[model samples]
Target chain A: MKRVIFGSSWLPYAFLAPQILIVIIFFYLPAAEAVRASFYLENPFGGGSTFVGIDNYKDVLTDDNYVRVAKFTFWFSLLVTFFSLAIALLLAVKADTVLRGAKSYRILLMWVYAIAPPVAGLIGVLMFDQHVGPITDVAALFGYKMQIGVNYNDTAAAMIIISIWKQVPVNFIFFLSGLQSIPKAVREAAQIDCRSSWRRFWTVTFPMLAPTGFFLLIINITYALFDTFAVIDVVMKNEPGSNPMTLVYKVYLDGFRGSDLGGSSAQSVILMALVLLLTIFQFRMIERRVHYT
Target chain B: MMETTSSNLEVEARAGGRRTPLLSQRRFWRSVGDHTVLWLGVLFMLAPVLLAFLTSTHDAVTIHRDGLQFLPGDHFGETYEAVLFGATGFTGKATGLVMTFNSMVLGIGFAVGKIVISMMAAYAIVYFRIPFATLAFWVIFTTLLLPLEVRILPSYEIVQKMGLLNSYTGLILPLIASATGTFFFRQFFKSVPDELLEAARIDGAGPFKFFVDILVPMSKTMIAAIFIIMFVFGWNQYLWPTLITTDEGYYTLVRGIKQIIQVWVGANIPEYGQAMALAILAMLPPILVVVVFQRWFIKGLTESDK
Candidate 1:
């Protein structure tokens, strides 16, 4: 895009070679390998592989446990995305409104963003530990026993909670930045025209935030799909037996632990397709967005 | 982050002065309600980590009996000392100090490698003319669609084929293949004024000189911001490190979180105290970086992704 450009064919390629070589070796090679491996029935014990067209995909899609895991993944993504976004939006709105201790609130609400997912899960595990968990003790007070990593729903609930907790800071940052970027003229106009603050927020503030919200929706869904792998892995205590897991975790379990390379590759290809669809959908939304400026 | 808006201050001042008692009371209650919501949110974020820190101070037996401690205990010094300096882990070689070193290597190496390579790549694409430039750009940026997680198996096999397992290069190289940094730098380089390049050309400055003299200096803040974000990302990485590093010596602090719980399992009361201490050590550096360089961190995070 530079008007005054350097015209050196070898120099450009020389500079690009490292990034391109890395991409080919790591990204492209593995991705192509995944797609190719998906079509084969490969033995894990160092043997020949049979080119079994779509059977691996068929096996994955038709298994009952796979179906169950898929259902849980869907619900997990939805619940994590919805709760994290909602809590972040509420916090951002309140933080933006309050003049007292606002900076303190902003810092406190978002510092947890630096904690890794597994670390968050570790804290969650301690919080929901069977013996030493304060949250478990609180649950006992309420007559609801919490058995994380043992009871299916209890483990799922804990994972979701920790995932949401880890994710809130990210969403909060984006929403707060979005709220701050809203023009003062529009805000004052809304203040004069609308008597009810709630109504004003819905009509003026919320509409202005639709772009950020849309951007974050895709981000949150992608997050729930992949980045929560650490939390799920840690909370399931490294053995995901009948515990709920996102699709990403299942791929790891089947591929690495289970050593079903062909089957895992099939799942990988499926996830790649899913991600591509989501990204394309996101781009479409961005293209169609009504730019305020 | 929370700038004091003059308009908001003026509105609050008006609400407090000469307003009807009824209106002022309602305004005060609304402010109180706002503060309450924020407090709950802060508490929700803080309590788990606070409990983790507090529980880290107690000895294993006490923690096992008392649940998570609400307050610090006397065993804090011993716990932290043992984790940091004492020979621990299944191999007795993966002390917290060693893991922390590995984590720092990964973080700093990843950020520096990414920024350097991405700058080169972006500089080539933006400032040079090449026949296969479009193809290179497309191939590089397409990495954004499929994350490393999706192709973990194949990637592992590839790394295995290359025998990169247990090496620092293996840990860092494959992860940096993505074009996140390139994409960011490309956008930034495009925004840079064309006149600078023209002037440099007029001054007979070659591409390398122009890049070194003008662009790199201009990109100082950008590099710093990206460094912080990438440092946190590399330090926080769990899945990749979990797979590639079979050696105990290569365990990163984030990757070691699962290990603490897994190894100590059924060892009587388990070393809950040390585990929490390790977790604290894992989180502290990145948290400090983000909180300290908050503005640059936010910019790197919020801008780079887009």
Candidate 2:
């Protein structure tokens, strides 16, 4: 968009070659192959595949297990996005109120953003380990037995909790900044009109935070969909039948483990559509409302 | 001024006389509530790490027998030594050190490669008037949605066909063409003042000279910010390396930690101590980067969102 320019056509192309090459080779080619393969029944081995138009998609759409996995992924993404946003909003509001030690609190809450999903998963597994988990000891104090590995609900709960924990720091960073960006004068004006803190927050602060909330909603869903693949992989490695098998994980499982290339390609294409829709929605709707100031 | 001061003093005295106990109590409770919530958040964040570190210190027998120990044990030195230099006693191929090295290579390679390519792409798009430039930009931008998870099978096949399966290039290159980085750099470059470019042109500096001198220097903070993000991302890659690399020498720390936990001896128990140590090792570099570059990290996130 700049008016000032440099270089001829060939020079620009030369500059673009490396990125274009990689994108085509790694991204476009594979994406094209996935789309193409979705329509064909391919052998798991390197043998040639037969074009079975819409059959792979039909099988995936009708498969009961795929339905279950899709349902689980929907609920998982919802719960993670909701709880992480709510918890982060609470923490950010509280941290914003503190007149002292706010920096230390922010630092403490923020460093966890650096921990990878797999590491967070390992931490969750260790904390919830039935035999050696300290959380089980705490649960014993409450007179409840903690058996995460054996119970599907418990395993699903662990995955959700870890996903929320890993995601809260990111949401917190955004929400805290959002809260700070709401001018003090606006809050004070509201305070003069309405003395109740809760009412003031609802009428003034929450509406002001809508943009950030919407943005984080999209980001958290994207994260829950894709980024939690490692977390689920680690937590459910021993319990593959657990309820936390998201669509992304299912793609990997069906393609790599089940060796169902055509089926997995269908799943992949479906996931791509879902992500593309979410991304387009985010850029179109949510981005327009984001208040930069 | 005297009238205003006296009025202010009168108001302060009247309020102080009546509101002291009620206001002090409310303020005390509010402070207490804030600190309590903040500390609870801190505990939620740090407890897992503390427990991981604590469990790493103890011997596996004690852990297996007594469950997770809250207290630190005496095996810290020995456990870390064994994890770093010693073998897992099952398949003694990739040690903790070698895996760490591979992880470092992958992380640095991935970050540097992404930065270089994206910078050039952004520079060309922002500074040059090439044909189909907008189309090219959109093509790169659309990649934001096409993560590896969506195209895993074919991507793996493509890398395999390229004979880069076990090499660092295979591990890093495919993941390096990032839409986020290019998008970020394009925005950053667009913000660079036009006068700077004009001045450089007037100075008879060539495009390469202007880029290496003025642009790269100006982009140092942005580079640092992206470096922190991309390094952590690259270091934590799990599925890609797992799919591509079959050799032990190419194993990264993140993948290696999972392997340590999964690798089981026939009769012996899993190496919980070593696994914990490796987990801690894997966490160190990224945590260090975040802590060291905390300012730039936050800045990058905020700016990129804008």
Candidate 3:
């Protein structure tokens, strides 16, 4: 993109070799491997795999357990994406309005962004631990004995809550930055046009933040899908016995513990397609949003 | 003129007095509401950390007997000492200190390696009119579509076949294969002024000399920001490190979490305090980095989204 540039034959390639080499070995080779293995039934034992065209896909698609995991992943991503964005929007709006000590609030709120998903999940497990958790005690007060990792719904609830908690800081950071970027003149004009602050926000500010919202939506969905792998792993304690898990976890479980390489590869290919679609959708939206600005 | 202005202001003030107090009251309530919501959000973020840190200070038996602790217990010194200095995993090589060292290796190594390699590739792309440059960019760009999670199994297989298991290079290199760093540096390099390059060429500076003397110095802040972001990302990586490092000696703190859980599950009265301690240790560095370098951290994060 630079106007003035160096024109060299071999020097540029020399510089790019390390990166290209790593990408070939890691990204492209493994991606091709996933596609190739999806067509074969890899023997769990050391014996060689037999080529079974489309059979692995069929088994994974028809399996009741895989269906359940897929359904959970769908709903899990939806809930986390929705709630985190909403909570973050509210906090960002509030933080933007408050005049004093906004810096302190931001540092407090966004520090959690640094905590890894599994570490957050570990803390979640402790808080929801049936024997000694404060949350379990509170739930008992309401006569609802919260049994995380034992009851299916309770485990899902813990996963969703912790995932949201881990996610809000990033969303807050984006939303807060988005809110601050709104032009001062626009806010003043809206203030004159509408007397009520609530109505003014809906009319003026929300539309202005659409680009940020769309970007964050895609990000939140991706976070729920992939980043939560460790969170689910820690919460489920590596035991997926009827416990809810995202699609990524299912891939890990089937590949590593189940040792059903073909089936896992098929599921992984399915995930790859889903991510591709989401990314394409995101790019289109981004292009459109760019046009508006 | 001054008296007329003063009388006009006095009249306006007297007329608007009742309306002003009501508006002020509304604002007062609004401020209260805002502070209340923010405080609650802060507490939501703070409670888990506070509880985790507090629980770590107690003895394991106390934490086991009573769920988790709210206040510091008497075994603070002894517990941390044991977890830090004690070599006590099944493999007996996973001390807190060693895992921390491995985490530093992953974090610092990942940041440095990513920056160096990405700068080179980005420099080649942005500064040179090389053949197939666009094609190279696209190949790297498409990687953003398929995450490491999707290709994780096969990646593990390739790494295993290549005998990279339990090696730091295995843990770090595959992750740097992404185009994120290259994309970042390319955009940054494109933004550098053409006059600088023109001036350098006029001074007869070669490409490598110009890069080292001029571009690198100009990109100090950018490099620092990227380093912080990449360090946190590498330190927090769970899946790849989990898969690649089968040896306890190679375990980073983030991946050491699984070993901790396994030990807890096997133990009679799980080491709740030590588990919390390890979890806190895993979180401490990243949190400190983000909090301390708040501006640079936020800048790198939000800008990269674009």
Per TM-score, the best of the predicted structures is 1
What RMSD does each model have against the real structure?
2.5, 5.1, 5.2
lDDT tens per residue, model 2, B25-101 = 66556666766777788889888888888889999898888877678999999999888787654236787888889
Q: State model 1's lDDT.
A: 0.89
For model 3 chain A, where is the 10-residue window of minimal lDDT? Answer: A96-105
Q: Name the top lDDT candidate.
A: 1
lDDT of every predicted structure (CA atoms): 0.89, 0.84, 0.88
Candidates by DockQ, descending order:
1, 3, 2
Give the Å shift of residue A19 in candidate 2: 0.8
Where does model 2 sit among the CAPRI classes?
A: medium
lDDT of 1 by residue, A29-96 (tens): 99999999999988767878999999999999998988898899999999999999999999999999
TM-score of chain B of 3: 0.91
Q: Which parts of model 2 have CA positions greater than 4 angstroms off?
A: A7-9, A141-143, A290-293, B1-19, B89-91, B264-268
Model 3 chain B: ten consecutive residues of lowest lDDT = B1-10
Q: In candidate 2, what are the lDDT values of residues A44-77, reduced to their tens digit?
A: 6677999999999999999999999999899999
lDDT score of residue B280 within candidate 2: 91
Return whichever of 1 and 3 wins on TM-score. 1
Query: Is model 3 an incorrect, acceptable, medium or high docking prediction?
Result: medium
Going through the candidates in order, their DockQ values are: 0.74, 0.60, 0.62
Give lDDT: candidate 2, residue B207. 84
Runs of candidate 1 with Cα error greater than 4 angstroms are: B1-15, B89-91
- Model 3 achieves a DockQ score of 0.62
